[model samples]
Target: MKKALILSTLALLISGQVAAKTWVLTDTESNTEQGNWHISSHQLNIKSSPFSIEQTVLHGGKQEGSKLLVIKSQNGLTITLIPTRGMDILRVEGFGVRMGWDSPVKEVVNPAYMNLESRNGLGWLEGFNEMMVRCGYEWTGHPGMADGQLYTLHGKAGNTPASKVEVSVSDSAPYTITVRGLLKESTFKKADLQTQTELQYVPGSSQFSIHDVLTNKGDYDHDYQIIYHSNFGQPILEEGAQFLAPIAQISPFNDYAKKGLSTWQTYAGPTKGFDEMVFNIAPLSGANHQTLAAVVNKAGNKGAAIHFNTTQLPVLTLWKNTDTLKQGYVTGIEPGTSYAYPVSIEREQKRVKQLAPGQSAHFDLTYQLLHSASDVNQIKQDIATIQGDKKVEEISTPMAKE
Candidate 1:
């Protein structure tokens, strides 16, 4: 009986030690654990999942009074969005690498402080730095009067807050977290527009998807335009970084872009007094109407790529500004339904899309961070294949009437 009792005690002690051991799966490719771990125990068992979504409010500074949703995946991707800022995605991080530019304004400022004055008013540009700053439903450009009505810079979409914000997580394999926000832009007896925006992230992947639906809820036909002004900054947009796209044609929007046309694909270190340049590009499309563009850092072996539907968003704008290194140094890769020019110009060109009452349009875009050198190289090769045997055509900018 004594020997049997001692054997039972020994078995219990052995099991406890075995359960206390931690087991982790190391990623051979990256030589890291990548957060896949599990611990066994008698009292409880804990395991780490591939993805997580969290919501929190930012306090103090410019971010005061802002509710933010943070989505993280095991693949080292993290995205931050502000529901108060028209559900705009403010920041994207992957593997300790920031994929967006840092705005001068440290916090997300309240829209109450928006300055809409023409000559002196800055509108949303005052705090314009975001991973994705949505433009439109109305006008998006310099402040001007269209049809005797005043329009501010980039319109009011970014300033309009969202309602019915929801965050949902999937329980099945390949777990995904999705956040949805509904924004209404309207005025009594005037125009009414409802924009439904969603951000989705999947586990074990460095990509996030954005889906948006814009509807005209007014009685009269309404002009609608939108641009996803996605920006990339340092480390990704550094001295050795390059912009790669399957462009069929490139039109310079100003004399500055024309003068530097030879070096449009190359980037320069931030310089003082550098004028911002804009280019309108027609991207080569695939059979399914897919298009791709990327900004790659050769030195850092990192890159950021965008996959979008060219049928829905046919125009691509590249805005490069090194004007003020400390204050405003960024490269913007914008895909939109219309050019970033004034609404009047788009109207004259018959490019302004009118949404009939009760009609809606949908847009989809995906951003992927290339964490591995091989992944970056693969994208570069793809862009090369698309540009094969064809030279990039340079055309004059479409003139806007005075």
Candidate 2:
């Protein structure tokens, strides 16, 4: 009987059928089966075969007072999501390649400190250092007041806290893990905005997906603007980094961008006193309403790409700030429902979208990190074909409207 039992144990170990150990740490909320996790040395680990999801809360230093969710796949993809910070993605690394930039702000601050009244209320800029930050239901660009009310830079969505956060790991085929949260941006006697967000990571793939739903719970029509502020920094945004997109129309936001429009596809080493440039682009439609954009390093060995629905997000903004190598050197590939203009200007141009009471809009975006030469080459070929087709045009800048 002892020999039979030993053989059965070995078979279970070989098949990986042995139940995984789980650990959980919480202060107020009760843990559920979906939240089954293993905590060791203050790390929350949820194992599902080859993929594991780890949860860690910041205690001290710059990361102090923040809660982060780390997802790891057997294929070497690692993603960190911060639930306390509007559920923004903090970092993405795969195959020894760092895919996001580092912000000068060393510490994560509570969303309560997001001030739009200090120095033009650019406090949001300090915490803007992340892989992806969702901007807006009212305004998203410069700070301005409309109808006797003031709107801060980039709105308040990024600073709003999320509730009902849930994490789940699946053991089925094509194993997957998901982190879901709900962010509500509402005030008494003001507009009501709710955003439901979900981040999904699958094993054996270098790509993940973000699904969001924005709804207006007010009684009247309300202006709405949302942008996926996706930023990429070094080693992906180096001196020779290349930007690729199927741009059908491009418009320079300022004279500086107009002067360098011809070489906008290339990048230069950071220079002192470098003026930032902004370009608004309308992507060419693809099969099933999809659009593509990417940034690849000079060596073309590492890069990141995005696939989004042009029908949902009709505009893309490319922000280049190459001021100094040590600081203020980053690029943003943003997709939004409207241009990154002031709220008044957007209204004047009739570009702002309106959500009626009880109406909701859904946005879906997929991000992929390219770790192999083949993946990078594929994007290059797509860009080449887009340029060769010669279906692109240049539009007048917003200043021209003045």
Candidate 3:
């Protein structure tokens, strides 16, 4: 029995459960671990079978209304957000990028439709509002996908320079992403994958970390925005899913297609049968920052709160979309620095934030799951607690970038 116990302990150590391990997968291909599912760094090519988390959104942006992540534990507990035929395929397309219900679903403009882009991946990476080539910025898709495609720091790099792989892990288990070679339009020699941006994760939850790693290797200052866009499926939202946000008005894009709902109005209480909603907030100032969240539902209310420090990012945008056309099923809770409208409009409106060269900025946000609540009071209370004493930040720019 002692020998068996020793062997079991050794096995656990080899399997790497003493602490969580962050593996840096590559952007070009999918990585699979035998029995486990296949995953790319971008998280675009999720496995399809064994009832695991399959990619629900398609490359064409066809599946819009439902959640797409499937999570299966080694213990045989199967939980999915909203898995239907509509939610079966992974969408190479993006939310507001192209062919969005807003106006036209232009494939060329769709970064997912493109085989290559600047950044292509998952978990809340922001895309610039505009496409500027001279700025060394080429539209790849969203920063998540665009960055995933153009650059990747995969594999492990030991301390030895000769043995160092493109990717490396310090004594700390954080997976580090490194970029080598000339960046699109900047000039810098070195950059580190910085996930300084963080969100709170449940202690024992299967999904633990939502992180971001940014680096500037350019000569000129990089003025960009990065956001978090989370796609949720069923299992997480049953018949009575609800959402909440501390916003004054919900407005349609001044540029995109007109209003499906309305441009600017009071926050709708509990939107049951709606497609999506968008809100606006200013840059971060004080230590206590403002945020928005999804409230209650039959399954469970899961959402995140966003906080941005101006030195790194200057704006915050809340994007909520449901596939009313699909089956009234899933919703995407995306908190970004910029809106879906054109960057030209944002700069025209003077809403864009600029990041300087070699300078770094940081922020902290939290994503928590909640059960059914009595009313929107819980949300209001949480917001009040988070933003206590700090003044509510508002949009002061309506001027475009020149």
Candidate 4:
């Protein structure tokens, strides 16, 4: 099956439509294609059609009018982009594997229908179905009353909408598909933040890269925090699945997590009341401070890897929620500047970022979709090289309040 899927990917590369064109899907400033915009291979004007970008709106329920972009690449890769939900990546297909989960919340939900402050600040879970979702601009972590403000689980970023969206293909070889969006978090008399995120991937490759430039549009220097909640489930996560990383320091987020410290790097089958466990890790890196982390299936033949740099995102949070699939069985390989506790604790720990007026922060990360044993094994070897004789610091006690 793996060989056949790989061959199909190669065939897609060999037989794809190549074109150099830019489409303005949505531009609030220029007054361009803004409402329920869509295009197909026929309208794209590309010969033989190696790829196509299409946008459409979902109907009914909480997903009403949710805008989704389905981008198909030349390497037989396809990804669904949600503009209505902070421009998150919904799902991935091809590449000898399927990257998605059976989230009970089946809607590409629009933010208009979600009450982020409901359910005692845990309302973000109402539409939490994406594969990758950014978790902050002001603050993230769990929800709590801190500094006289009620901070919600994660933050407003995932539930926020992008102000603008665009798609373009490279003019030359590689023909990288770039999906760009601008997400803003602002309110009256508060911190005003915006991030221009570009998700780019070559047509014939099994990986994609994210470039984000977050700027404080407000005059005041206010605190901000962001965590990339990259999640996986099903085929890549199961009983006996392994979480691999080059660790510099590791500790449990709470006492419950500490109880499983011995098997922290391992996963289990879904149990009815398993609930969740979280681990905080300071990862080791190679030259240029590059870090890698991944989770492979029980057989170790398939996996997904997150490539990042410690310079921008220095903290890693492993979230194990291997409960029943009906209750959203999944794992989050999160990278952030701070651990997820509460906003007050993050501020006290100095993990929250403060940007000066006109100052911006840059972040770069790549998602490599691994399919075969060779690819998965290669990543394991690369991680081992990064560890390179370093002693890992393991903590037995709880590191923070959860």
Candidate 5:
């Protein structure tokens, strides 16, 4: 009996059946999985399913930090972080999503930003596919005091002292994520302090975690921009893709400016012939914030879906292809930390959230991907089911701590 028990325990450890395995995926090219997917740690690894190739950056190389996972869908959709030099360029070669980076707009110059905070590298949530905050941008081009890339995510840091980020993958699912960070100081100034954002991987459910501790190390109080950049490209947004939002009017960044000027004006109809589409969403109404849908259809085969969250975020930014623009290559269904202005402008517009010396603010949002819908109403019903009647509380869980 003792021998049997010992052998059973040993078997469990070797087979990794009781717990997930943290296999460092590196140096592998794209390939399909007969059953399970592969993970490696070598510089540039590509994992290919029968239908798609998922490439990750072990080395962003020659350029600064382009460290992001690249996905190439079976329908010929591809995505990669643009090099630092192309910071302002949002591109779509085919049916793909290109997340662009713009230099951070200085708050001091604009009086509208008296009590605002500023950071380098796209403001708000411009880095990834989704912005997990109220109003924010994707990527900013500024380097931090330390060598790491500085970014702001959703949620509040408050009195916490430690923070961390983790990401995991399952044999069947695409990705899982979670984040935690410490709030060491009450006053955080973007220019003064240096910080390190670490990535943690563990054996458990195939989920990713990201966490940070934002501090008000600065002398005065300021409202910081909190956003998450969630970028989905290619196969995710194909030719027949559709997006939904609670929008009565669509506006440009600058309505009366040049055609390509970062304008914000009410959108009367579908946006056509433009580089990208960025819109300002209205305030939250009950459970509906906004929804962006995308669909790709070739012949009769169709893949469609919608993306959005609840009250935590109140704006939506959509990008599609016009006659002069590349249609299906990229479509950004972005949620943000603030509307399209500096933090100061947000404050003037009564859109900024204040953070005192010892005070903190908590923000929450969620995103769900859909597979099929009977029609527009059915699709709306599907979203209603996911965003049904639950509020996301900002608290610590086992998934977040790991």
Candidate 6:
């Protein structure tokens, strides 16, 4: 009986049916799965799936002291997550394609070294190379002064380090890996907020997902905003690439954004001194209030899509910066609670969300990769279905409020 039991255990191990594993890389109160955050560097060699995940601390450049978690799957997926920057994704690579832009900023900038108030409130651009990054727990619009207070470019959520990070794997099939990061924003007399961001991946799939829960812990009600700045460039975003979305209402952000209104959904290769343009879009939702936005390459054989629910994120902003490669060429398909406008404007427009004391809100998004023409076409069809029978309202200029 003992010999048979030993053989059964060996068979389970060989088939990759071992028990689940959990690791706490920075939990402050837990002891069993906790790690010493004070330590400069360490490795957590997680190997329960068909792939691997490694944890290490960077030591050079603005990214110094940043904690980078790299995941590699047998399905050719590579994801880099930075816990030091509110669990923002650094880059994603798979199927001979990359999911990030070529920014002038070469290395990742540690949040501790970033000054969000510098350069006349444009300091947030210093550490803006991530493929996906959160924009706020308070504000995410342009820098301005309101109610005798100065608001910086974007809020502090993306620049705040996570107080706790934990990794766990499912014991069931597919063996998904879940990485959770906790970020807190608080002050003595100001608002108190906490955001728990979870990034999950199936080792052998060409997709990943983000789940975020934000809670207001202040004594009174508080208004907040959030934006998921999902940027893309290079191979998947080129000269003739197209932006597909179920647009119910669309308007140019400013006079400059109207220059390319004729080909708003089309892209240019690269130009010298090409200024950026933005389009404020209200997306149409299908069943269950779900929507999809995509960018397919010129050849229509490769693409990427962002799947989100319009209930939580009611607006989408499309940003195009087809500048020269050296000057950083990219585009952003941003889903957010409000448009990138001043808090006062959004409030007047009734787009700002208010949370009662101790209330929480949830946001979810998924990133998918398409490697074939059929896959890309399927997304286009899905978007078209959402647009059925709805007349698109295209404004020739900015609204009177702007």
TM-score against native, each model = 0.84, 0.86, 0.46, 0.92, 0.45, 0.90
Winner by lDDT: 4
Compared with the true structure, what per-residue lDDT tens digits does model 3 show for residues 285-360? 3333434454344433332223333443444444444444343334444455555444444444554555555555
Clashing pairs for predicted structure model 6, backbone only: none
Candidate 2 residues lying further than 4 Å off, grouped into runs, are 1-49, 61-64, 383-388, 399-402
Note the Cα lDDT for every prediction shown: 0.71, 0.73, 0.31, 0.83, 0.31, 0.81
Backbone clashes in model 1: 0
Instruction: Decide which is better by lDDT, 4 or 5.
Output: 4
lDDT string, candidate 2, 1-402, tens digits: 122223323332332442333233232245322233432212333343366676766676545567777877666588888777888888899886777787776666567655756776566887777888888866687667677876777888777767657765443434455577778888887778888888766656677778788899889888889889898888888898889888888888867688767777888878788888888888875555766788888999888887788888988998888778667688889999877777777778777898999999988887878887888887777666555677768765544331
Best by TM-score: 4
Q: What tens digits encode model 1's per-residue C-alpha lDDT throughout 311-337?
A: 888989888886565777789998988
- Model 4 segments more than 4 A misplaced: 1-20, 36-49
* Model 6 CA lDDT for position 220: 91
In terms of TM-score, how similar is model 6 to the real structure? 0.90
Candidate 3 vs 4: which has more lDDT: 4
Window of ten residues with lowest summed lDDT in model 6:
33-42
The per-prediction tally of clashing pairs is 0, 4, 52, 3, 86, 0
In candidate 3 the C-alpha lDDT for residue 202 amounts to 20
What residue pairs are clashing in model 2? 23-37, 23-38, 62-107, 116-121
Model 6 clashes, total count: 0
Ranking by lDDT: 4, 6, 2, 1, 5, 3
Using lDDT as the yardstick, the better of models 2 and 4 is 4
